[model samples]
Target: MKVFDKYILKSFLEPFLATFFVVLFVLVMQSLWLAFDEIAGKGIDIFFILKFLVYLALMLTPTALPIGILLSSIMALGNLSENYEMAAIKSAGISLKRVIRPLIFLILFISALNFVFLNNIYPWATLKQKNLYLNMKKKKPALALVPGAFNTDIPGYSIKFEEKYGEEDNLLKNVQIADLSQSKGKIKVITAQKGIISTEEGSKYMTLTLENGNYYEEHINKSMQPKDRAKMPASKATFKTYTINIDISSFNDDDKLDDEKIKEHHGMLSIVQLDSISKVNKIKYDEYTKNQADYFFNILEAKKLYKYPDSLIDTKLDSVILNNFTTYNKSIVLNESIQLLKRTIDHNKNQKISFKDKRKLLNLYDHEIYYRISFSLACLVLFFIGAPLGSIIRKGGFGLPMIMAIIIFVIYFFISKLGGNLSEESAISALFGSWLSTLILLPFGILLTRRATQGMGIFNIDSVLDNIQKLFNKTGNKTTNL
Candidate 1:
């Protein structure tokens, strides 16, 4: 029995490793291609390049694990079926169920690993990836600009250098900078024959190492026509060692996260934790709670605007309806104080409304907040579906199962993305939006595996089509007989 278990385990390991490698390669290759120009052109080191790919691979592993399992399981089982190994075991009085037990245990172990990944490692990796992007964005453009090229990405500036040296890091000769930094927004064209980039206080600034550099700058709001502005333009400064601060733009808006925990809290926290923080820390929960609250507020707000009585003079009717709306809306939303701020912004945008009324409406948005927590936990739900599915759909190899896994996983990914968005905008219940993809795919996987194990055949899309054809033929024959 131990030998049988070992054999079963061995049957899966080869395919499992193969699928994992393929998936990792696919992920790293895609990201490397996307970042190729930046890495190669910008003189980025291999260490940084490797770190970027590693973070990306980590983020993608959870997304790819299910597909790996599906493909690997299919390859392993299909190989077994092709060799008549299953038949032999059956002849020896061993059920297919018993033969597959060790393999299922292996899958269970993998599922546990996936659970840890989804909850902890994945979130950390993705967050790191975001931060990396942010740091790149805030880094100096001059450092990234290729010598002898028209570099225009810098803020309110442009540069072109005559030469580059040291392969990656060297000074530029005959450098020209179009600096538009005056009250009149004039352009200062500075030409330096020789210059070197130096780093000080953790910031990069260009230091003109030689004299003989002509300087042209534009003054802001100069009383001159277009041609006159060019000739008699703004204040231009020239110096041999004019050290200027490198333009460092702030991080990208999405990446400028103040709270790492909030961004990552999605894949963490149990239902009880969700309820606990949501219940206790009304103020502290605002960062994460906003999404769920949006769900409830959206629904309640819809009810208020669209659910008005048909008759305008129906004061009694309006009074009761408005009261109901107010009550329900207030129950689920964040602090009503934020409502006052909303009303102010709305009023400024030519939208006249009562702060009292708007705040009352906005008070009911908490339902949407809790919905995201529900969605994050559904990763476990997907694992359950992915497992038995791969087992039942034992095809020739990874080819068929891989396709199926991609289709299913993409659908799952898309549905959650859509639901999470709609939930934020109040198009669906928070719980429903978060759990929508899982719920939809759960029954589908269940139905598919259920049919497979019941002698209906695994992934028998062929038999299904064949049966439909036969049924049509039968109906045609019956009509002819009639």
Candidate 2:
């Protein structure tokens, strides 16, 4: 390798490694903070927590890589330019392109590595992280319950509360519980003004004590008469104190922690898996839509209506046809038609919702495939942008370069998120949404590179002013001649 190439490589590598780890650490810590509630007080082992962090860092590597590249590229080139090394190289007939050639190849390799992480390591880490987090939550189910939302992490109960406050965070206020253990022909509900949760060490049961509560139960029997069922046989009672022991043995099983039962999320799929699943789902969706259309058509007897001759289907023929039928027959026919129309309307409404949900799911899969490709290329794209902007700005270190890198990255991040959201809603095609940020930034990068190479500022303000002055001069001359 040439001495200059080695120098450039060393300069870029130092900042790249420093910035990459810094960005990765920040991202991992941010994720950990967001999930602190789920992890804290769950009795998770320290080693288990470390493993989760490793998985989290692995999962977030692709995300942090591009930002790291952008910031470091800016800083590296900015330092060279600020130190007059860029000018010296330019004076010595070394073009900006030649100076960054080694770095360009390096960035390309990093982009490929980023793709590998996105395509393989990301999915594995996502699966492991999700399963581990689920197991942690299940380890102590009481800690999983958050106020104001239905908590179904427990086996046979749905618990909700307006408030949970106490030194141990076990006391609840305005608690409601739905006992789904009796899944056969019986329903029980309990509501309380206050409640307390207690779990003993090495015990299989958690005791819930409710104060000033109402208990309601509804019973249904297959042998009961229609009239008896219509009456809705039920029981109700009020109690100052009520106690229920919930069996939590199933959730306390440590062996299940390593089990990978939940692996269907799009994030947990590779590009090949996503493409295969998306194709299959699209075919199923099309078939479902076609079947629904055919079913509704048959239910509405549309074929029979269309089978009549055009002459007999006219508005005048409608009156004649009704006149031929007796009034009683006419009323029965009209009532049946109205009911069918109502049924068709209701069916269409439901089908619309079903189709929307299916399409959204397909969009998610499609977006993931395209997003992986686009995100991997972001290292290359952002490098072009950051390196050029750094050269033009002619500043080094974490001062101006850091600010510029952050602003550019923020814009890129916002566009990516917005595009993904729109894609998920079916407002835009997944392919377009996934590449939207790249498409938007590529031109800016090109423009910056061109300007920096030509020794021009980001905007040619002097040229604009000169053009305006010339225009004014022409206009004044024309006015004087007139």
Find the candidate with the highest lDDT and give its number: 2
For candidate 2, the lDDT comes to: 0.90
- Candidate 2 residue lDDT tens string, 1-482: 99999999998889889989998999999999998897687556677889899999999999899988999999998899999999999999999889889999999999999999999999999999999888877676434788999988787799999998999999999999998886644378999999999999989899999999999987876577768876877899999999999887765676667778899899999999999999999999999989997998789778797677677446355576667889899899899999988988998898899889998999999999999999999999999999988898888787887788889999999999999999999999999999999999999999998888887878899999999999999999999999
Candidate 1, residue 128: Cα displacement in angstroms equals 2.5
The local distance difference test score of model 1 is 0.61
Off by over 4 Å in 1: 31-45, 142-207, 211-277, 280-394, 418-428, 443-454, 458-482
lDDT at residue 258 of model 1 (Cα atoms): 23
| Candidate 1 similarity to native, TM-score | 0.60
